[model samples]
Target: RPATVDYMSVDAEAAEVEIFRDFPFADFDISVISVEVQAHNYYELDTIFVTAGYAKLAVLGGDHVYAKLRRPLVPPQGAAEWQRTIARDFHAHAPARSEIGRSQ
Candidate 1:
């Protein structure tokens, strides 16, 4: 079995916490996690992830994005530049556009 998971997108239907509790994340390098969580359960999720050395990067609708930043929640240098790069990449590869127009 693959113990190292770099990214996990979990939509366990409110059983996310239960599922996560069983995994030994400390044994591997988990870079990003996107989990389905109820709005009311944000606090619970926050505590669990924070204790596990992750920072909540964003909360999109019912999903939350968490990343292990090696430190507290402060943004790293050139945060705006990173955001712009991400946005550009997302737009360049958007599904509505044709592959012929996408940058390599």
Candidate 2:
């Protein structure tokens, strides 16, 4: 088994939710997941992802993309601590200000 999975795309037709449920989330630090969902199992899939600390990013065609709610830290920190770290990092790397010009 690999140490971590950066991305995973699943198209299991009617069995997508079943396959996703069987995935080993505890064993892998999965950053992104894309799963094809049908109306019958959309809620189940969403619940599974949300419970696993993932948030829906987008829906491309029939595939729903989910990203990790909190990026895994090396030392394994708490969620609140991780959020603070991310906010600090974002501000540190982001531009101080932005200028938008409109053309008439």
Candidate 3:
């Protein structure tokens, strides 16, 4: 049967691009992906991820993290979304902005 992936971690050495191409990202909503990329061709892999609606979040050593922006995660959502949520919640709780920052 087919399955949905919330996260995927791939360490394909030099075959990272080939491995990534095997997945049909168009059919599923993948939340996050971590792939081990080679210094010489990580950009190619990044282009593929970008075409699939993923954004490069970070790079640690040889591993890179990509998040599918079309569907965002909660609790620890993306920084931009988190900021919006914080502002909205604050405004709902305190409409007036006092010297302390919260609205009276």
- Decide which is better by TM-score, 2 or 3: 2
Candidate 2: residue 56 Cα off by (Å): 0.5
Off by over 4 Å in 2: 71-104
Q: What C-alpha lDDT values do all the predictions have? A: 0.80, 0.82, 0.81
Evaluated against the true structure, the overall lDDT of model 2 is 0.82
Every model's Cα RMSD, please?
9.9, 6.4, 8.4
Error (Å) of candidate 2 at residue 95 is: 32
Regions more than 4 Å wrong, model 3: 71-104
Model 1 Cα RMSD, Å? 9.9
User: Residue 9 deviation, candidate 1, in Å?
Assistant: 0.5
Q: Native-vs-model 1 lDDT?
A: 0.80
Best by TM-score: 2
Q: Is candidate 1 or candidate 3 better by lDDT?
A: 3
